[model samples]
Target: MTIFNGYEQSDREQKLNILNLPSLEAEAKKIIPTGGFGYISGGSEDEWTLHENTSAFNHIQIIPRALTNVDQPSTNTKVFGLNLKTPIMMAPAAAQGLAHSRGEKATAEGLAEVGGLMAQSTYSSTSIADTAAAGNGAPQFFQLYMSKDWEFNYSLLDEAVKAGAKGIILTVDATVDGYRESDIINNFQFPIPMANLAKFSEGDGKGKGIMEIYAAAAQKISPDDVRRIVKYTKLPVIVKGIESAEDALLAIGAGAEGIYVSNHGGRQLNGGPASIDVLHDVAKAVNHQVPVIFDSGVRRGSHVFKALASGADLVALARPIIYGLALGGAKGVSSVINHLNDELKIDMQLAGTKTIEDVKKAKILRK
Candidate 1:
């Protein structure tokens, strides 16, 4: 029997048969470089927001309906005009090579097998072309980091368009990198050379070229650059890290076709509202002009259902998927996704919903 088949096993046996995301995280903590695990798993000071991200969901419950036929509930949803087999999408994660040799390419391949959407990080270890090739021409979105030079930024946008990325996600919240204690203690810099950044810092003399340029541009550039990049890319622009309704409106006004409501998985602001807490406001702010994607505090199919019920059009997860990859590479990742999909199907059936559209139809009570 396959490892995932827990038919006659006890709950404890099933739990220990093979590690899930959390167990994999513990295993990864033991195997990966001290700094990398901390960077990926640790949140801001005290990790209060990080705790809040996950815990907040528990306060909101899913009121399952009774006395309804739920034998064959459908779990399909379309994002950016593409029909995805499930509503879950993979979030953009950088330095994946640090986690595994297959890196983003392996992730693309695994995600392709299940018809999942993969979002490529701007700080990816592999190039855009490599990821696209690995996805076998599957629809992927390019996540962009705002830079010091508009011309150079536009050039990257052109490359993404040429690479066949379905959309562009501008990470607006990370105007500056946060104080990540894990990276500080372990010294985890991106594994690959950012060729575009190298030339931009010709004479910083301190031998800190890329990080310096990154820090300087983060402080110097205005939102106008974000507008320009959106104008330049024909692909739909998705503005990520939008915490407030005002920023959501600003992002929409800047020509973003989608808004990803995230707190950088609580890797950034420590005292800010949880990603789940602020999602409803952001969705209400947009008034349906664009689809709202959510991240931060998602680990199970129940969490996916919670986000959809709260108003997220789609949901993505970073650390869990990373843990899945670290534990078993592509197979581990595929297992987690497939499990989540299965749970989602059962959850929908139990809730008396037969379609993705019906997911948003549930009546949720908020305090």
Candidate 2:
């Protein structure tokens, strides 16, 4: 059982009391340093896509059904043979240590307590084995950022699988960093050691910074690489950073078990459509061949409900989750997951739905 197995949340929120995502960010801002906050919160260039990612939800109205059996509304779903008590999961945001001293271990602990799941990043401050242990048997997936050295990936994948990783999420969008003006204006770098990366880095790693590491990444990746990684790991591979129907189809053909729809939380491009705006079309393209996961601009239970209706198997968020970590350590992340799940349950009841399937069949009109 989790440390807060029966602890009341009202009493627990003393560290990070929050009403919504915005409030969560505000509360966390009171604690996290200036540079760290900007790195996590700010988007690329002008961040138009960043603003649009959330604002797009306002235009998509949920057509609530009435007079249905909604008494036993359930927010449970399964991904990669693991049960997600709630449909919302954590996106693989790197460098979580900057937000809290405990970093990914704290996140794993928090999610473990609440029956939630997460995908740990290649740049995580905590290693796969340690994070998995902190999870206390929670099913965890690992996200990969392929390096120039295939040997590094080979060792990393071996470590992750041996550590009991449930699946692999390959992020393909960010070969290089987005032009986040905030990081430049503040001249910030992650002060904490990226535990998973240092061992893989060459020649002491001091000369090879995170930016340099990304710069040296294999940029000419193709569908062939997906097939290669899947063959190597012998585990389910979800090709992340897919923004178009074509890429989704290619990934599916290349043996991707899942298709992740994301724009790197609008931290990649300045002028791209909101992830939600294109989710339906991408889902339509996949046509049930594989589970389509979504991230970018998910801040509410209604957003979770809508994404299901739009054809997402699971929804994810990053910045708000990190903020939760910054505020209350393990419990803070637990509260965020529980808070979103609670809203999803209430949404299912009020919208005349009962199960995860019903939510998928929910009527939503994009205005």
Candidate 3:
């Protein structure tokens, strides 16, 4: 498959204005408010895991093959029964309004433009139905946080299914809000009302803050909760927030259709090992029983390559999408996807791989 159509001279000139991923981030920092930037960019206390996530990729080296016939490499693959043009998916992130006015809807549109998949967070500024509609029927997954009220959680699941969500991503790592120093200092509050739960009354006495509701609801999740969620949905259930082989096995045994290995972008757990560092063991434990999806600290095509080589069937992008959105809404988001797709294609050709499967088989050496 043609992962990225070559850019025109005009388009190239426009892209040169934004350039690379770090440049996009630098641009985003200039536009985003201090509180919003802090919330999106900061990890938990000390930020050890945050730094480790990206640095882990540095510990491994890709050994490219020589002189292979890779004149027309394809980046197409199937994951969880969805035909993905590229394995790089837009990771579920909350409160997109903080990044852009259009919020999750803009993200959906951007992902749809490139035939990429999106996982919409429960705390999204756009409702599941609205986000699905915005995608114009592109494949979308619902990222669910199990609520203390089982009825509420089940109702949300039903709403997502009716709205045409292709799968369910049950996030398991956030039982409580992380002690983010930035959020604490800025006293950051979700800028927009959560579209999905806007009509639902806040009679639970959890107050009106989004973070409070998220923390209270997520506290109810357990291993049995994973099994319950799987049974509740006919669509595939992907358990996100898995960080080790042990939890990976537990999630699989609980009937998860897929495993998402993450640390909530290092937004949770101050000093945890990087998600990439745990990916190999998690993949081994799953043993191909289910696909392993990865996120947290993927910033470039090389990071994408390393994640796949480490046994991630597909990788997700998070903070970068927000950065893109901060720079230019849907167009900026599309640019980020296009840039990554183009980079991945070039990396595959350079690495002498011709398909997504070839990427899976590419050699790697630990430094």
Candidate 4:
């Protein structure tokens, strides 16, 4: 039985009380369909890599320094030229409508309240414009999926800029969808209709707008689309899903200002290296020319420290926030982030660091 098992969400405020990441997973599992649950919760075949993602953090230990006047520690981190209050940024999750009625709107608002950022997915249930509006133009970024059609691609970039997204994050990892057993078994399609496509095309059709554009472009359009989108918007571009130094180099060549070292939470491509494992190398390859961000298996403040030591300028968490949302919409989401923020501050103080930059200067061991 899971932590959320047999428990009921009593009220709005109570939702935020669900502090731990796994604490809310149970509620989400019970509320969503088997397929939907599987899509969001399950991992690739065998899920060994998923388990390893979290377990890998176990090998490293924080060597904290004591006896200094460490009072209020700053958990702030900057990404794509924006300063956020916490090292935690909201990961781009697709089909958020599957988790809550208000979906990304709730998420954006909650993040706005905390003065943080959420990397809005191109596949989000709410339109990017609408999600930004919900956040009232708070610090925000757009995650892009290169579609087959360049026109649709350009249109979406235009929309992101018009909607007040401060930057764009291009997802290059999902060239083809990964082998997610839950999505396959459940035959998962997004629970909500693709609501954001109407602005690009006027009818109900698969691959409309970005999807259609993505289909047409395939591998042939990737490089050009990257340049095109960058040319079209002054907003900084971050290339996410880069797994290697080579890809990182390519991202830089294409004028990307940042890269997210992620493997899609082990949801795609089982048996791949953990995000933390490759972080150091990726960061080195970029030679500090641009910032490197990471997601996957970051469950605690120490894990946040580990990623920073590994060279991530910012770290993001997905399932944890989604788990929080499942238990209670906006408030639950804030609870999870706040919990991390509290823990991070405590951890930094214990480590004798007063700011996030100090975290970078602290020593780390990979054993």
Q: Highest TM-score, which number?
A: 2
Candidate 2 structure quality by residue, lDDT tens digits, 29-107:
7667777788889999999999999999887888877788569788888867778887788899988877777789888
- Best by lDDT, which number? 2
Report per-prediction Cα RMSD to one decimal: 6.7, 4.9, 6.3, 4.4
Greater-lDDT candidate between 1 and 4:
4
lDDT of each: 0.75, 0.85, 0.82, 0.77
**Candidate 4 global lDDT:** 0.77
If ranked by lDDT, best first, what sequence of candidates would result?
2, 3, 4, 1
Clash count (model 4, backbone only): 10
* Tens digits of lDDT, candidate 4, 199-295: 5554554324333534443454355566777888977788888889998998889888888899888877899988888888899899889988899
Ranking by TM-score: 2, 3, 4, 1
Cα displacement (angstroms), candidate 3, residue 261, comes to: 0.5
Query: Candidate 4's error at 7, in angstroms?
Result: 22
| lDDT tens digits, residue span 229-341, model 1 | 76677678888998899988877887789999999988888999889888888898988899989999887788888888888888999888776666666676676688788
TM-score of 2: 0.94
Segments of candidate 3 deviating more than 4 angstroms = 1-17, 203-207
Name the candidate, 2 or 4, with the larger lDDT value: 2
Steric collisions counted per model: 0, 0, 0, 10
The reply for model 2, stretches above 4 Å from the true place, is: 1-15, 202-208
